[model samples]
Target: MAAPSRNTCGTRERSILDRVPPLLTDLYQFTMAYAYWRAGRHQDSAVFELFFRENPFCGSFSLFAGLNDCLTFLRSFHFTDEDVVFLRSVLPPATDPAFFQFLRGLDCSGVTLHSVPEGTVVFAREPLMEVAGPLAVVQLLETSLLCLVNYASLVCSNAARFRLACGPRRKLLEMGLRRAQGPDGGLTASRYSYIGGFDLTSNVQAGLLFGVPVAGTMAHSYVTSFTSLEEVWPRTLVTVNQDHDPVDLISLTKGWLGRVCELLGAEPGKIHEGELAAFLSYAIAYPQNFLPVIDSYSVTCSGLLNFCAVALALCELGYRPMGVRLDSGDLCKQSVDVRGVLRLCSEHFSISAFDSLIIVGTNNISEQTMVELNTKENEIDVFGVGTHLVTCTKQPSLGCVYKLVEARGRPRMKISEDPEKSTVPGRKAVYRLVDADGHPFLDLLCLALESPPEAGRPLSCHPLGGGSTSLSVTPAQVICLRQEMFTKGQVTQPLSSAAETKAQVQDSLQSLHPRHKRLQEPDSYTVALSETLHTLVTDLRRASTNKSNVVLAN
Candidate 1:
């Protein structure tokens, strides 16, 4: 595929370029590119793999996201004239102008990308993506790829944890726009939150740009607009019968309001005028979907009773009230109390639909809050999570690193004092092994040149570092996790829609064993190397140690 010509760059390309300039990369990337150009090794074939060392949010798996954005960046990868001019002005005087020319002509056309499809469940040390191309070109992609993947994966994992805590039936909404790091961060959170199983978002721009479903309820300001019942309904009579049975109170109030309004020559069926006016106005706007925030003043005294009256009045007008939102107070106790009120109204008013009214809780909810709420008896049907879902408060970052694993068709590895920091060497393939019941038992990494794992064949799986322990398994199914995302610098696969990607996440999570999905001290999923790959890793570690020892002696 030919590089996108500067003159022919369209609106979409320009949008991508605006978001990710060629100079968006770290300065070291350009310096290394220049060094490669000076040494005439810029075109050397190299392979780099992107992976994380540990799961974020203390969870066993992460939901892969942002591959679409990474692909977009790669497809439009090239330095503009402005970028070239900036580079010339900033580099050392000893640097060559030809290096700028090389950068100006650079594109990812020579690169081949292999990646696990976005929304797949990824674990530590498994290659999430691989880039193969000319050395300098692939090197230039490191920082941007990491930037896109790390935060996206982190947010998605956090959202997934929220989803797990809420269970399958409850609604999860992402309301992190105001609390996100920035505008772009807010948009990213909305996108990945949907991919991680959130049902909706409260960001309008995110909904417009990324097609995430947008939803919201009235704010406290809406509730505070009216000063008194008379202002809401002039000449309308209102009464509260405290002595009536709690179950029969809503019916009696409805009757009293009707009789007073009739005697006063006013709106006969208009409910309690002040707070109910706000709800009535909102109902006029969204008749079929009327969910009003009720806790602006009080839950039991003002909010719940007022909402019940307005909701029942709307039901009489042939509109089904969606629910009420509890934004403050003891959410667990308040939601149950609010539900009891709705139940009483449903019984008295003969509105069966009132029983299905959703109680939405949006008071600084977090994953821990969800877990705790799950243990308590509460009636919260929907949860709107903001800061914690988007910011990943438990563990803010997913430590994904992109490293060169092969150069000139020879395997390379980075050895570190901390073994966990060491890079796995070579061009590799990842296969998910499934057992008889179709649950993934383990992920097996092997040399790309080796034969793929065959189902029903017994194989020895060894963990890295020559450990004595090994897992013997005969897989019922073999699934190759990575697909060619970009071949010869052009996209090889169609980008998946957000909905499709979300479905992928849901399916992958369902296939995983429940134990691995646990939020606390979850069972670890096995990620092992094939026997041949383990042997290769062992040899490479020994060679690296020996070389270090020799260097010390010298």
Candidate 2:
């Protein structure tokens, strides 16, 4: 294989892929390659398919992702002199030096990849990607490709599920950096989360590197940093106009503070001056976007009061504060209470914009919590989700496997005692059948040489494989799902940007039947085989079972 061709992307994003050096794969991959070399089978042509057996998070579907990273990794794969030296010291002394020389010249030039488009909704048992190349190189690609696709696809699917749990209208923010595995894990989560329908992220590096929208607010420390208005000195604030003279904003804030205390029936002396000063400082810094965490001291007792006073003051100065965030307590109850306060202020002051101010729920929110929030009434406009969003706590890992399905132009199968573990042999074509309503009805697997089903034509297919039941229907639409993406050391397809892929996710979801995409008890999406494929696999399995003297049920 030739080093992945660098002609597909710009230098910046290309650098992300370049970091995936050839040594990134698992140790067993190289060991297998070495064994193949000793048998003079290293250069034999082979085909490997990457697919999962079930959906992650107990959901009915997954979104294809990390195609960009996979391409990048393949494009830049090469054993450097240093990598060879490391391998020499690690391998047994009986290892031939010529093997190291063979590795030095390995690259992805001969490899070709065909994959489902990134962000497209995919189901279990179907190939998300296919890689074909010389036996040794393609075998070595197994672990690394799975490593990139498994978690990338899992986190992306998890984020999408969170979006579904919250509905389409609510904003979803990814704040998983602190809870992510590491810097790269955070970066991966941030990038894929955006593509999975998140509106923004708190990771500045992700914003810089992947173009994810970045947003955040002052923390509890920012509020606790001040104790008196004196520390918030020169409390003058200027309008957006650079030439406008600074106004005595601190005085205005105090006046509003008194008004808020009276309107909310609170003691004027009860409001903490230090918290007020902190709010004042933050408001001055980001008047147009002064969202503050309100649960530090007291959401109702002091924090909310301080926020309202400073917010009203900023509004008086021709700037509207964005909103507030709740990080603790009964989130739904607090959200309701906070909304009541903001709505009362909006009506009292005739500040109609305040009626729509964002209320962010920053609890340790998960998909389950979001669902729970819907049953109880609340006014949370956004959810800044952490931990579970990136880590996929409900399901830690997606089980995607890469298997050699063909070698030297011959189809192969891994016959297993457990039928679930058996491999579907050979290169095949996949077609998605759409109903008259534009919803996908079934996915058909056919031998690569078979003619595809055309619209309005009746088709017969086995249910999965070797099943008695067969599907009988005429498809309104027939779409080829997998196509060549990378080949001849260059990307054959024009890769979409993350934003574009995100749009595709929404569109893909819309194309599925509602029942198939529901959160719980989702109707399983149908995947079946064409007559030719069904017969081929059934006979192959039967012959293998007979050879082992095992009687199989019909």
Candidate 3:
């Protein structure tokens, strides 16, 4: 079969879509595209905005993501000849031939778009992106945008949960690749995980793709490959002593660690006199046991006790093996008991063993369970968040929907019995209110050309009123919310790096009022309609309902 010809997005400079996301959307988008053409709505100008009604993972806040993916989707969007031919083969026998003729001329030429800055903090109900163009073009974007946002947001929310639980020591790693849906699923999950606060990932391709730090340790397979667990050390030591070994390795390893003391200009004898001395010596001799596997099968207290003996021996020999790996049972209890054992042994030997014993947990670390374990004093360090983190088990989808907000100098709204589902009517913009401190407090939605009062002034605009301030903003300063992201089809802003995005999420969360951060029954952020929008919605409602009433009265 011949490859389909690509659709050209009407722009002078190429977009990221020129490389990826071209094939990401489902087949139905094309079928819908054909229908729009047949109905003569293909070139009829329209607009749609993307936003979600709630945050995921039951968290107090959410991180904004997937704008890059959205832009890439838009830029790469095109009807390939193969795509067209497939549509031709699938069209019903009775379908109009003229519709297919129109499909042949399809291109994203008449579309105009707008969006929020990617790293900005957002809330429920507000539009993140506005797509205005032909109806067909707007319809085509729905599936792809939601696909990107849903997954990205899920991982971001998950990462935030971990960040909150981890406290000051935020050493997190993404160990979810193998269980992720596909290769890219793992890759993107790691990307957003870092944006949500993880330190690194174990997926090598993901690390290279998004510049995330990749981390891994020897699997049990390495140990099983050797004759015995004892021989595992000598072989590992040989590799550690290879020609490419770092000088730091010499100081940190057993054979040459005495040299580490000398290089640091300290007496080797004195350095070995402390509790950590024995562990350091063993590390130099047998670095393979760094974070040695303990509960490979059963995670019972007896299992931990057996490993505790080996850990004590390594500590006595001056090598603090990395940490104890827990693979099975009652982690909260076992970790506490293991720490107590190490402490007793260190005291008996008159050595510092507390720092030498690190408890690492793998297998079952989802957001909910991690929070539960984090609350305990016996909780383990270094969680391997695999299936749950990668799969986004709690809220697997973002539910990001795009709808038209305005066109040709007129406001519009989507009406629904559910007020929360009701679209904020008009050509509108979102404003974030900040206080005297450079922290965000509330988000205010208003007409694109409207401005609210200054800080300390009465915030008198009803979020849903027309030309009247029904509910004044309760005593907070107003920070202008909207930012210029694109002009015409050209990008006006630079993309935020993963590091910057994570920092933004952290800072934004700190700035939020305590109520917004509550995991349970989080106080909803104040979202009010600008008076104009409220009035417009009210009028539309009255007109539609009144028309029905008139018919009934007749």
Candidate 4:
């Protein structure tokens, strides 16, 4: 790939950003910007922090994602001529054209962004991203930034849970293309799911766009297409010997059917005709990658037996049968039973290929289902997870909020009646503290100017509540979590590929304590404030309270 232009305002970036209108923001953001402009506070320096208050799906951590997309939006943040015209039409009849001119000239050239890297495991209340610039310009970014990060992080976290359930060895495939929220949502899910440790996706468009590996098998409709064995039997069969005549196809088919009937204790003519035809046709079409959906009619009684017959025939003709898919019934028990049948067929036919056939389970599997299947003895080699992974039905949103934290060098915060809704004030820096065993014990948030915690030093940290917790650090390391993403509207870091980001997630998860990664009732990872930041927050709250009291007394 070519390096980005030094000018930072590339035609490619502008073209990509052109697709996103300036009016994509909420109407309230425009109103606020107008108010600031009227008061001559539009150009005043300000800071905003984007963070979530709680983990989605009741999990302990969230996978930070969509930083690349957010940077793209920032780089391409200009209002088009059409946008200004539309704004004029929407404004009141007596509105000034100077406001439209302001909109026309608006861009993000003065903004600086700092963010945790994509694929980082972040906790609630920690800043995922921070924007520092003019108050009006920064305010305009709130809606778009939240829209990009919220869904991406939610889907990525959900995929991480699924990855945990599948373990390290089992293959996990994203089969959610048909069930995703929309076309763009499907592509986004595939891209982030790869970063969250999925092996492949079934969406080919995503594969083309994001370089994610694409995979899929024939649907059940392919089976129903061949209504009878007569449509596929003799025509699709191939002779084992190259010198043998094509006329021997019928005899070969009959010989395989006889063996299958004898092993299954069924009459040759009474076998499942349509399923057998489909398997034969599909095998003939894709002999090297034949994985027939076996539960179209019956798994054990008919589908399994018919597949074994077709597979044995293919083996005799020098082709390796790939696998079988069980898409219905109790997948755990059905997989065990199907494996037994394959083993029995291998012994009966004296063929070793039957014993090694892959079994895939794909019937609406969820994270809990994967956990349950992991506990039981089963023969499934891969999981084709779909709706549950893409839709994130358990928790569809990751409540990420972008709030103003500082303005004109003064720390600011939003006080709320609910304590959880209260904002963390200031230009903050986040550091991950690793203990002697190399596990991250806690995350420390401090004023950006305050000195970072040093190694081999005992530090006192305070949680959101009033209590202070002390950690004795004899062999620990403190590492900064946030990096400079954008400076003066230019991206500072090269975008990471999906494979690289996936590896980062895997490595980060390895260093995280297992207690914090549990699916249910996970232990909360400590996110604390440094002494200076804690003191500043307390002082601000006290001052705000006194001012409110004075107003009421007056």
Candidate 5:
């Protein structure tokens, strides 16, 4: 294949700062934008916050992600000529020409955006993002913003759980491609995995689109294509290995190479168990020299011992076979004893095999077992995560919803029997209370300018030494959760690159406590009632509940 072009100069230098969103937004958003313009409420300043009432994956805290993407989407949001033309074609006969003309030049110019820079340990009801602008502008943004944030946050949180299980030592491969909901489903999962701390991904498209690292190895097809071990070794060495890796083990006898080869349906050789032991005795003699695959037979009883034989053979041959593989059977048990027998076999040959052999466990690994296996920290070196990792079959969605909180200077609320599902009234902002260490303790919601009582409350108190926790304000003491990302229907900020966005997510994961990162019952991040909002909630609750009671009483 020809190498991809490296054009130093190309088509028009793209406007990275003023990116526009695709025109295929939810129809309601456009209709609302048009209505606001028609009603002269297009420039009325308003505020709305984006938040969730429950954590995805049942975790206590969620790592913020997708802000970069959100910003990019905002910057690129506008109705193009093509969009206008298409609208003209699709509008009903009752549609007015003036409305279509207004939309022809329409773009996001009146909105101001603020967000809790992606990667904060946020909780339910804490505004992750805020959009204040003309009523129509804010309303139009609802669907797309929710669509981007909800799914990104969900996958980011799930990836964090996987990170907890693997820790810093184990490398992770995000294999969730085939099972993702749609193209964006898999695409977003790759982006989220990077933020949640995965090392690489198998999706080449995802890697290119998101700037994530890509990696893979020989699949089973390569193993089945060759006739003998000798042929396979010579072919691989000549085609892919020799120039890249030139070492002593690179030179081998054809006979020994043939003995090393084991293919599917190949007959077993006549070596006795003791002869097998003798061959492996010679195997571990060289270090960092060779690697052999051993899962062609029973991976437990005979597989473990056969691995020992290979190790011994390499030792006597003045080389160490790099590792063994377990492709079948209860991996949990095999992982435990493989370490034991490999140790015992190496010692018997007097080869001092500490850290000499690596064990690769592959096939059928799921999120559940991967979590459990990783916690144990055995001698397992790498995981060949295939089908399960690539296909995120369970909980493959982020149920993000967006509703109009206010319009035309009037407060609004969606009455729902499920209190947890109720929307708050009016425009608001979310603030966090910080401890002495400058870490956020809890998030409090309040009217845009109303300060909550706990904002300056001392976390801990002392009368004398000044060491007692006093309400201290540092330039770094409080982080403004929102920033201006758009204005006057135009994107004002530079679009976040995939790398920048991914880094933003990784940085956010650091602030969370360890227990709050688990996949099971995660420790909850605090979302609390502010004094004013608390009262408002109380009053609203009583009024609504009383109205229902009055109806019942009648």
Candidate 6:
């Protein structure tokens, strides 16, 4: 656990942004950069906002993630010599050699990023990060910025949604690595899911890279690997006892096995011996962290009985078994049944620890399923989430678009046949208005030049205001969401670690109203434009349509 080192560029030594290079963008981006250069607009100053049209999973809120990586990318954004050579070869022979020189010299030294703190709860049509720089350089950044933010925000939002469904009492384990799209996707899911409130991850690499706690258990494959007791040769183990002797743990475990079967109404001869032996081997290997998948044979018939036997034996050796995982069947009923059995064993055997053995529910557990589970009584303590959390099957992608909003200090708008597709023009500043109770009541976006909102005053017309309704609330605190992150080829803002970001998410969630984060029929959080910005939009629309009475909002 050494302190992180910083390079001359001010980026951390081991960062996610190091994995991304300047060339990891679409060909159209390069083409557009070249066109901007060809038209003599390469250095024309432009402002672009990175935002999403809607929250993924139909949820009302999303956590702004991946900002750290974006800043790191800016810190090290320069084309390698090889990249410039390849671009020269790809372009037509008539292409100016000066373009390649420009490419080779390209870096984001002049770029400035203004963004909300990472892990802030964001809404639709609100800017998460704003980039201001030369049009060519900013255009070169569009694809990579969106690529880094979209899925990170989407999966983090998904994980937060699942957390809401499960309640705060249950522990969440990210087990989606095996079911993710690829290695990178899996690793991303692990990192963001933990930041989104997951307690642990099964990806060892994520643990190593992101400082996420890692854990695992014996899978069904391991349970079925043995067919007889003889397979478990050298069946002795050293315990915490100071006797310094290898006790025959297998023999001791077998003694308790018969007792467990008799109490659970299973014939010892008919019980799954291979499964029992596998459990013992796993226990011997990781006595302190033994949590086996107990549904491999039969939860109550053999799996539970064998696990209880091995667990009691471990207790005798002064080792505590972690618990068991329920991977199949009616999870609700089985979880309740398992808890009852544990209660009985704890009371009968005078081993009070058995009463609190963790019961983890797995196997296709969805958000809806969790909602149903919460309605009934169950003893499941942890959720081992897989495909749904990582793959984002409910809503796979977040449409975070990087769009030009202003150029050459003049505000611009993109009016469209679809209002949702239309762009909000200008360099905007974002604010969160908090009430006396410290809950943020609304989010306001205004032109950066307009006076910032005050603690007490009449706020102006809504950006979404097509009608006469206006917000006139006096806030206890008018908090600015924007902070300078990058300038002069360095990250100017202090960055937060994964643990710090996750704590921010927790705090932000608390500050948010519960209605906006509910599992079903969530209340929409307000994101409005200031009076000046609204007036500007109004004039822009009127001029575009040559009509006086038209409004700017849907």
Candidate 2, clashing residue pairs? 1-107, 1-108, 1-109, 2-107, 2-108, 2-109, 4-75, 227-274
Expressed as tens digits, the lDDT of each residue in 180-251 for candidate 6 is 989889988998999998999999887766677898877899999998888886788887674659888889
lDDT of 1 by residue, 344-421 (tens): 667765789899999999989989989999899999999999988888888988999999999999999998888888
Model 2 has a clash total of: 8
**Model 2, 227-277: lDDT tens per residue?**
898898668998766467898889998899889888999877767888888
Q: What are the Cα lDDT values of the candidates?
A: 0.82, 0.86, 0.63, 0.84, 0.58, 0.86
lDDT of 3 by residue, 1-554 (tens): 11111322222014235424444566777677777777666777666778887777675567777776666555446667676676677767666777666666655555655676665567777777777777776777777777778778778877776777666563787889888888768778888898787887888765544556777754544433433223322222223335443333322333333322333343433331222332323444555565555554343322343344445444444445566766567778877866765565556546575465567777668767777877777647677678888888887876777766665446667777776677766666777777666656567777777765466776655643223447765545666655655444555566555666677777766777767766667776656776666667779777878888999999
TM-score of 3: 0.78
All candidates: TM-score: 0.90, 0.95, 0.78, 0.93, 0.74, 0.95
**Residue 175 displacement (Å), model 2:** 0.3
Candidate 4 residues lying further than 4 Å off, grouped into runs, are 1-19, 233-251, 267-269, 466-475
Return the TM-score for candidate 6, rounded to 2 decimals.
0.95
Model 6 lDDT on a 0 to 1 scale: 0.86
**TM-score-based ranking:** 2, 6, 4, 1, 3, 5
Counted clashes in each candidate structure: 0, 8, 35, 0, 48, 1
Question: Which ranges in model 5 have alpha carbons more than 4 Å from their true place?
Answer: 1-21, 34-40, 229-327, 336-360, 374-377, 384-394, 436-439, 452-479, 488-507, 538-554
Q: Which ten residues in a row have the lowest lDDT in candidate 2?
A: 1-10
Candidate 4 has a TM-score of 0.93
